[model samples]
Target: MSFSPTGQAQVLVWAPEAEQVELILNEGNTSVPLKKEEFGYWSVTTDLVSPGDAYKFRLNDDQEFPDPVSLFQPNGVHGASQAYDETSFNWEDDNWQCPLLEDFVLYELHTGTFTPEGTFAGIEQKLDHLLELGVTAIEIMPVAQFPGDRNWGYDGVFPFAVQDSYGGPEGLQRMVSACHQKGMAVVLDIVYNHLGPEGNYLGAYGPYFTNKYNTPWGPAINFDDAWCDGVRRYFSENLLMWFRDFHVDAVRLDAVHAIKDFSPVHILREMKQQVNQLMETTGRTHYMIVELDLNDTCFINPLEEQGYGMDAQWVDEFHHALRVTMTGDQTGYYSDFTGISDLGKAYKDAYVYDGQFSPHRQKSFGVKAEGNPGKQFIVFTQNHDQVGNRMLGERLTELVSYEMQKLAAGAVILSPFLPMLWMGEEYAEPNRFQYFVSHTDPELAEAVRQGRKAEFGMFHAQGEAPDPMAEETFLQSKLQWDLLPLEPHQTLFRYYQTLLKLRKELPALKHLDRQNLEVVENDAHKTLQLRRWHDEEQVLCLMNFSNAPQTVALPLNAKTWNLVLDSAAPEWKGPQPSAPTANAGTEVLMQPESLLVFRGQS
Candidate 1:
C-alpha cells in the first residue's frame, strides 16, 4: 500500500482466500483489523500509520506478508514493508528537459557493480565521467527489490520498490536529481513479464498470475484472466510511479515478448496511451522503450498505423550480427547469421531476418520494420545480458583484438540509430561482468551455480563458473576505474569521445533518415561501404573486419574528402595506417580490422 502526503495512509489488499485479514503496523507488534470490501478487497484507513513506519498484512490472523505494492521495502522483500512518502523528496529538476531520442548517446550500467560502494550515490559520483564522455543519458539496470543483494535485477519481485541495498527510494531520487542537474536524462529498466520466484506474494493476495501461459520466470501474469482489471491497474500504476515520483525520463520495458495478453487493446497499447496522456497533462518529457525479440515495428510505429506508439526499442539482432562478424564465433543463435550479408542487412534495413525462417528456432522470427524510423532502434555491442549471461562473463574486449573494438564503437556511434555503451566498455575494462546472485536459499544458489557452469559448454569456454554466492564473485565483477588512464585504454577513451563529438556536431551523422542510408558489401575483399547523407553533406564509412589489408574504390559525392576519424590512426595506437596513394586510382587502402570515416561537402 502507498502512503500519502497528509501524514495518513490507506492500505488495501485483495485476499479472497483468507477468512480474516489484519494490518500489522509499528514493527509488526500492533495489529489493526481491516474491513473487507466488494471484489474481494480488504482495506483499512489508519492515522497512526505514518511515513517510515514498518508494516505487513496478516492473513487469517496467522500468516503475514509484505505489501504487494510496497513503495520501499527498506529491509528487503521478505522483511516488513516501510511506509514511504513518494512526494516527500524536494526535487530540483524543474528546468530539466530531455534531448530527443535520436540525440541520445546512452550509457547503460548496473548500480551495485558500477562502483565499490554499489549504491545510487555511487552512480551519482560517476556522472562527471559520463559527462566527459559526451553521454546524453544514462540507462541503469533494474533496481527493484529482489532477494538478498547481488541479483542482475531481472529477478525483481517488488516492481514498485527500490532496492534497499542500493540506498532505497531517497537514494534513487538523489541519483535522478543529480543526472538532471548535469543535463543528462535517466532511463530505468523495468520488468513486467514475470516477477522473481522468491518473495512473490501477489498471487496470495489476488489472482495476480495465470497458469494458462508459461514463462521463463514461471507462470505469466494474469493480464487476460479473471480479476485481470486489478492486474492491469497494478502495472499501469507502477509505470506512472517512476515518471511522476522518481522523475525518470524514460522507462525501458524488459522482454515484452514474454508478456502474453490476448486482449483486444493490448496491455502495451494501454500503457502507451496512459503515458501519452501523462505527457499531455504534465509538461514533462516522458517516453517508453521496450526490449522485445519480435522484430515488429508496431511497438514504435504511429497510432494512425494501428500501432502502440512507443518511442524506441532495443535491437538484439544488430548486436548478434555484429558480434558474429567481429568475433567469428557463430555458436548457438549466432549460427543463423552469415556475418557479411546479415550485418549489412541489419545496418541498412534495421532487421536481418525480418519474417524469415530461423534454423535455430525452426520458425520465422520477427516482422519487417520498413516504415519505422532508424532512431526507434537502439543498438549496442555489449550489455548486461549479453556479457553477464556468459558462464565466465567475458566481455568483447577479452575475446576480440583492440582494433575490432574501435571498429565496433565507430559502427555504433556513427549509425543513425541511438547508441549505447555498457559500463566501463569505453576504457576496455579488464574485469569480467560475471553473473552473481545472493539468494538466501542454498538449494537455489547451488542450482544456479551448476546451471551457469553447464551453459558455457556450448561456447567451449575454459574454467569452472564462479560461485554466485561468494562475495568475491560480486567484487570481481566491479569495474576497474584505475585502468582508464592506462595505455591503449586512454586512446580508446579519446577515440570514443571524438566520435561522440562528431556525431553531435556533424549533420550527416546525426540524420535519422532510414531511407537515405546505403550499404555496399564486398565478400571478395571483406569490406563494407556505407554512405549516409543529410542535405548536401555526405559521410563515407569504409570498414574492414578482415585480418588482411584491403582496398576499395569510393563512389564519392565529391572528389575531395577529409578524413574525420580513422580507427587505425597512430593516435589510437594502431599500425600507423596511411591514406591510400592517389596514384592507386580512386580506391582507398584500409588497415586490417579498422574503420575509416570520410566527410565530403558538395
Candidate 2:
C-alpha cells in the first residue's frame, strides 16, 4: 500500500482476471515484474522509478497503459505517467491571505481555454488582469488529470494528480503563487462524486464508489457503505493536501448533490469541520463552496442549527431568471421562467422557483430561501455548465444585444449576492465552451460523441452537432487574449471593472442584507425594479427586459435621485442614452434592454 515520495511509482496492481502484470518503463527499455499478493495486489519497486519518469502498466501481453493513479502526465493523458517534484518550485506568497467569503468576487475560468497556451503558466501571466478587474478570488476549473489533455475537468479520474497538459502539480503551485502575489485568492474545483470513465483505478484499490444511491454520473461514491471510513478520509486528506501542498485558498465542490452519505455525521459536515480545524491550525481562512441542485439553505446555515456547513452555494435560480429574461428562450429549464415577475422574485428572494410548480421538472420544486444573506448565494448570468450544456455552446452575446449583455452584467455584479463572472465573459469572447473529452478507448470516445449529440437533440433540431473529439472544438474554445485590447471588448472589460468597484465602494450596493431588498414588477411590459436601502443610503435598480422602451412609475419618496450607472450609456459604449431623468411618483422612461441604477440624495 506504499506510494512513492513524489506520489508517483504506484508499483502495484490487482487484476485477478490477468495472469501477469508488468511495469513498463520509458522508451520500452525494460519491464519490472510485479508479484501477486494473497490479498490480490501486484507489487514492485525500483529506484529508477522516480518522479518525472514516464511509465505505465502492461497487463499480460497487452499494450502498455497509463497508471490509473498517475500523479503527473508529462506527455498528456494518453502518455505514460512521469515523475514530478512538487517541492522544487519556489513560492513567494507567504504573506498572502485569502479574502473572506462575504467579500469574494469570484471569476470562474477554465484553465484549458483561459489563454492561448492554456497552461498554468499561461494563466499565471493574466493574474494582473483579474486583480485589476477587482476579483477577490479566481475559481479555477478542476486541475485533476482527466482522460485526455483537453477537458472541462469534470471527468477527472485521478483526483490527486494535476493534468499533465497543465504542467502537473508544479505548474499548479506556480499559478497559486502568482495569484497570491497579486493579492487574489485561488479556489480549485474538485470532484469527489464520481471519477471519469477512463484511467479510473480507485475501485481496484478499494471501494471508492458504491451502488447504494444513483447519480447522473453513474455509481454513487461509497461514503456510507462498509469500509467507507477510509474512503471518506481519503477525500478529506486530499482537500488538506491541496491547501497544504499547493497553497490553494479554497475548494469549490463540483456537483456535491451526487455524493450520497447516510452516516451518523454526513461527509460534507465532517469535511467542513475539518476545514475549519485546519483554518485554526494553519492560521488561514480556507473555505468550501458547494454546487448543489437542492435549493436548501442548510448548507450555508450555521452548523449549530443542524445544517451542513458551507461558505456558499450557486443560485441557479438567479441565472435561470436572468437567462430567460435576456434570451426569451423558454426551452428546457428556461420553461419555468416566464416574465419579469420571476426575475424580480429572483432579485428579491434569490430563488424564483421556490416551492412553485415547475413546468420543466413537472413537479413542485425548490424550497424557500428567505432570511438568508445574499452573500450565501453565488449568482452568475452564465457559467460553464449553463453555456457548455447548450446545443451549440452559444454565449449570451450571441442571443442578446450588447446593451442587454451589459445590463445583465450590471444586474449580477450590483446585486447583493456574491457575483461570479465566467472566463471570457468580460470581453465577450466569441468562441463557445463546448463539451470536450479525450478518451483512450475508441469505442468510449464514439459513445461520448454520440451521447452528447443525442442529449442536445432533445432541445435543438437543425444543425449537425459539433464533434466533441474534433481538435477544432478545443481550439475554438481557447480564449482570444488579444481580443481584450479591442474596442467593445475593452469597453466591456472596463464596465466589469467599474461594476466591481461600485460593489466595493457603494455602501448600499455592498449590503448583503436580504431583508432590505424590495422588488416592483410590471409583468405585462417585461420590466422590474429592485430597491435596496441600508439606513439612509438607498439605491434603486430598474431593468427593462422587453425590446422596446417603457415608462414606469416611481414609488419612492425622494427629493432628488442621481443617476449613477446606466447599462445603455455611452460610458458603457452601448447604443442607449447616457442618462435618464425621473421624478418622485412620476413615470420615468427606461430604455429597452437596459439596467439603470439610481441613488437617493438629500
Best by lDDT: 1
lDDT of 1 by residue, 49-114 (tens): 888888888888787999888888988878999888888899999999888888888999999999
The number of the candidate with the highest TM-score is: 1
> Which parts of model 1 have CA positions greater than 4 angstroms off?
457-461, 580-585
lDDT over C-alpha atoms for residue 49 of model 2: 72
| Candidate 2 lDDT by residue in tens digits, 1-602 | 23466554446554545678888876788788888865456787666676557787787777677765566766665677776555566889989888877799999999988888889999988888988988889999998988778889988877778987888788889888988888899999999889888877666556778888888888898899976875787788788878877889989999888889889898999988888888888897788888988787777777787788888888888898888877777877778887577878888888787787888889898788886788888999899999888778888878788888888998899888999999889988888888787787899999989898888676565576789888898888888888899989999999889889988888888878888878888878888888887888888888888889888776555666778888887778757573556666767778888888888765
The C-alpha TM-scores of every prediction are: 0.97, 0.90
Q: What is candidate 1's TM-score against the reference?
A: 0.97
Roughly what TM-score does model 2 have, to 2 decimal places? 0.90
